[model samples]
Target chain A: MENNRGNKYSIRQRILSSKLTFTILSIIMGLLVGAIVLLIAGFNPVQAYRIMIDGVFSRTKYISYAIIYATPLIITGLSVTFAFRTGLFNIGAEGQYIIGALVATLIGYFLELPLVIHVIVVFLFAAIAAGLWGGIAGFLKAKFGVHEVIATIMLNWIALYLNNYLVMRPFLRRPESESSYDILDSASITILEKWKYSETGREWLSAHPYIKDFLSAPANLGFIIAILLAILVWYILNRTTLGYELRAVGFNKDAAEYGGIKVEKSIITSMMIAGALAGSAGALQVMGVTKNVIMLPVMEGYGFDGIAVALIGGTTAIGNIFSGLLFGALQYGGPKIQPPLGAPSEVVDIMIGTIVLFIAIPKLFKIIMNARKRGEKNAK
Target chain B: MLNDIGFIIGTSLMYAAPLLFTALGGVISENSGVVNIGLEGMMTIGAFIGAAVGYYVGNPWIAFIAAGLAGGIFALLHAIASVTFHADQVVSGIAINFLGPGVALFISRLLFNGSTMTKSLSFSAKMPRPLNGLFRSNSFSDIIFNQYATVYLAFILVFVMWYTLYKTKLGLRIRAVGEHPASADTLGVSVTKIRYFGVILSGILAGFGGAAMSIAVVSNFRPTLISGQGFIALAAVIFGKWKPQGAMWACLLFGAAQGLTVYLGGAGVINISSQLLAMLPYVLTLVVLVGFVGKSVAPAASGEAYEKGE
Candidate 1:
């Protein structure tokens, strides 16, 4: 028996074995596939990609726009990542998100308080509502052995319809508009908006003579909050006892149960936490971006897209922030690509799908490595 | 009242047909020990292909086959990822779901000149109802008998799947492999092959379900056409307790819920908005899933990768 412990491998060898190698390779392959699709569709791939990149970073304001789009995505990524680590496939994040948004919109309109307290109240109620929404599925899984995937999906539809109903009612409804009425000024959170110094939109530009270049992008307090939450989630998962127990239950429920960990309780808690993160995402979206509710033809696919973000990030806390940003850039740039390139913006969707497909098959790297080893053995 | 009930039953059967095909596919795949959440993706693909083909060829039957074949091809990707690469089934399924809509939408833009929808086919091109002439005078008979051909076919597939699963040799092998792969392998069954068959069949069924939506029900392909029907079908599989006949009953019940919503809302019998009414089926699915209707057990190795000589 040869002991391989403490054996130093070359940097190249280590890099080849590292999990990030596969992720990077998958990303490259995904981009290449997307480029190929673009080329096939009669567009110059280089030009299209260049345009996308340039558009996402075109101005000081554009960068903020990207971050604004990223806010919900990062939160949703954390939501999905947390559930994944806890061994639950929470396909119901979409439902949780909408419920959170609904609660936030309701509270934002009804609650009359100072700005900070109102925002806090809206978020708190949103999280509680969405947490309970997600908890129902968890409870079902724990008690009745119901599959969470099925339960969550069903809940998503229910949430969508419920939101539609809520948005149409008198209290929330805006006269002569499909969307709900705007939240009170106290409930809104906008950093750049305040900097612009106008009562509304670009009006502040004239009043704030020195702020001509002030980038009044949709970027707001939500993006900052999302980034902080990601770091906090990483710390909790890596350092906390609750996370350790949750991970143990995720790894093997029977074994964890046998080890005296309350597996069922962990499941409920993990789902609730995941739900809270997603709920906050929706709440933030309403408070930071829309400030009002609109009737949606479909549940915004943010929750489903969160799955891609979590998967591409390898389900790490820090990785989620980067991946969320990457996706946000793509989304911000997507509309720009179509007008100039004749490419459907949906190509981004295809690229994301292909990337996830490649990542899902990590054994592909193993097979390649084994083949190379076999070749070396033959040469020897 | 009787006419309204007939309308509800008719709509319910139409709605249930798609769920039936998808749920049967789910049962077949899960029975063979592969969990497929990609049914939604597969159905999306099938619906798009079915609609595009039907629009071009003007033949509903040809469109249906093309859809099923397209579905089978897509499912093969899942098989390669989950079976050959030993990836997580859920991950592979999710990837497929993503790909399905992306690919469909991309191709639609290419073929249909940037529209997210396919060219609509004439109502005459839809699946024929053979009993329409005979049942012209009777609402009950018309509703039950004079429906899309796929509606009849879906009910028929329930018996077909039930017999195949419980009575056929292939079904036994699939069940054995799904339940205890190592033991099945010892008995000389190729677990991989059986699982592949099961997943592929699921794709085909789900694909046909997609075709049922576009060709029989809607007659056009929209990105939102498949929506969450695939997930509802999944719930049907669980509610039915992984049994084909049980799945049919569950699908019908869910479909009936959808149909009732339509009837009540359309007839102004219910003062609630249609959006709120739409919540009935999904809420029912949640309630049914939560309530212990019976002992619903999934196949033992449904989501695990089987490794030889592990």
Candidate 2:
């Protein structure tokens, strides 16, 4: 009996001490702040939240759509997560994403290969373009001592204008519209109907005729690719020597250098990899979702969104998958709930911002824990 | 030909004024060893408040005060998160950036019945122009002298920032804290107070900059009023090598890029796509960073959290 009691108490103690507690607390705090905002806006917070939750999970199609939405975020989250693990802030993810999309679009437009080969080629093109784009900042940091933040921020604007310029004129220009022409059908990812139904020769659809919504959803190979990459990242970070060196560089660059690691090389490699992840996000976005490059009136800002995902995920591969799903659900579900609540979907942005802000200040949680500990001691 | 050059110069000055204020704000905060990436957020809030208040109160001066106060208050959140809690400054700044637009748009929707822009106020306030008498005779002189009040104020602030950083006892303490806070603490100067002042002053200046966008340049505040000028200001701080005078020059160079874009694109003198023209300032920022060889040095303690007696 005493052992059972002690076990329960220790589990509670572990919960209090674990970093997950703060992560959950920050999320709750963010929700409560969001609730207050909703209240001020004259909506019932509980109902609104329920609507949001229900909107994301009401049907299998909703769930599939959520996954589709999560696909790009997961990649971008991993991009930021990978960079964080290497002790570098790659704020150029947006630029990298753009460059990747541009490269992927070019390859998709010009090339006419078999379906699988075309996809692989597009991915490779995106990764290399974005990798080089990200490496530019790393090179500047390594060679010229330029701060990555300044360099990346500049790159983002340049990429934005470049994307706009490319979309508007001689490169991928549509005569009547600002957006580019859709890529060849061979370059596009197969839809769910083709993936599942075609494989089973109509047997799968006969068994699940009610799943029309599921068949219509844009979920593609990209979602599976994102999941595989996440798991691969976890394995690499835990098992690989390269990952070990990267983490060592992140933990302490001078010490890593003393330990015979090539600090500059690691920085460049990590940034390049990070950029590839973000670029893949762009490639997936174009090939699987948008189908073409639409001229952006303003920045799409998926890169900044990646920052929130990474921070919420605790900058870990495993955490990224979960948090990426949450952010993705919020994003996909936000608009669905908007009409009912008469609230602009931007409340989700507020929630995300608030969560990140709370998570950033881990000291607040620590202070509260210390105060609680002192209170218990006095009682004892 | 000279008249056209003078016109471009005048437009450049007008465009540079807001950027000048924001860059000055960035310099102050960074010099105090705090990395403020939330200039965009602060400017957004300032633009909204300045326009909203100016419309409601019918006084641009009072609106300016409200705008500055709103920015300072928003910055306090950053100070508390970064200074008191010792959170990562970049994360805090990003939070500020996200929260600013969300909150601004929300409030804008509430007050304006779903419109993102505030109602235009009839009374527009500008800076005191002292050079009007000197340039009254010629068109070139008119182009130079005909400007909003903020243009002159921004130029004067260049001198003011330079004087404050180099001449005063407070400036000495600010520089000391930025360079080496631990050493400054040993000399009995409070690093916390200096940093707070630096950050708050930055908020105020950036607020004025945003206000200049809505009240002086444009008639009202829209969600996109400040756009990416705060970021341009940030680049200016880097391009200027973190010096007041240098930032002023950098702002002018960037402003000229913008001025050229507008003038050439509007006049159809530049045959290239407007998108390419729009790309000039951003591309120049990259060129300036890469091409400049002096190796700009940041404050030694910048981006580090200082704890007393640690």
Among all candidates shown, the one with the greatest DockQ: 1
Question: lDDT tens string, model 2, B1-310?
Answer: 7887887898898889888988899999889988888888888888888888888887777887788787887788888888889989888888888787778777887788777788887743433354666676558978877887778888899899999998999988998898999999999999999999988888888888888778777768887788778877887887788889989998998789778877786678657877777777766776677777768588888888889989
Provide backbone clash counts, one per model: 1, 1
Q: On residues A66-136, what C-alpha lDDT tens digit does candidate 1 reach at each position? A: 88888899999999999999899898889899999989988999879997999999999999999988888
TM-score for chain B of each model, two decimals: 0.96, 0.94
lDDT of 2 by residue, A1-380 (tens): 78877675577778886777888998999899989998988978889889988988988788888988888888888988898888998778888999888888888888899978998999899989999999988888777777777788888877887888888776687788988777777778747535564657467666786465665677678888888889988877778999999999999999999999999988888888889989999998888987778777666878888888888888889888888899999899876656776776777878888988898898999899889999999999
Specify the CAPRI tier of model 1: medium
In model 2 chain A, where is the ten-residue run with the lowest total lDDT?
A: A192-201
Each model's lDDT comes to: 0.87, 0.83
Cα lDDT for residue B262, model 1? 72
Residue B73 deviation, candidate 2, in Å? Answer: 1.2
Please identify model 1 stretches exceeding 4 Å from their true place: A1-5, A194-214, B293-296
> Per-residue CA lDDT of candidate 1, range B162-254, in tens?
999999999899999889999999999999999999999999999999999999988899988998888788888978888899899889987
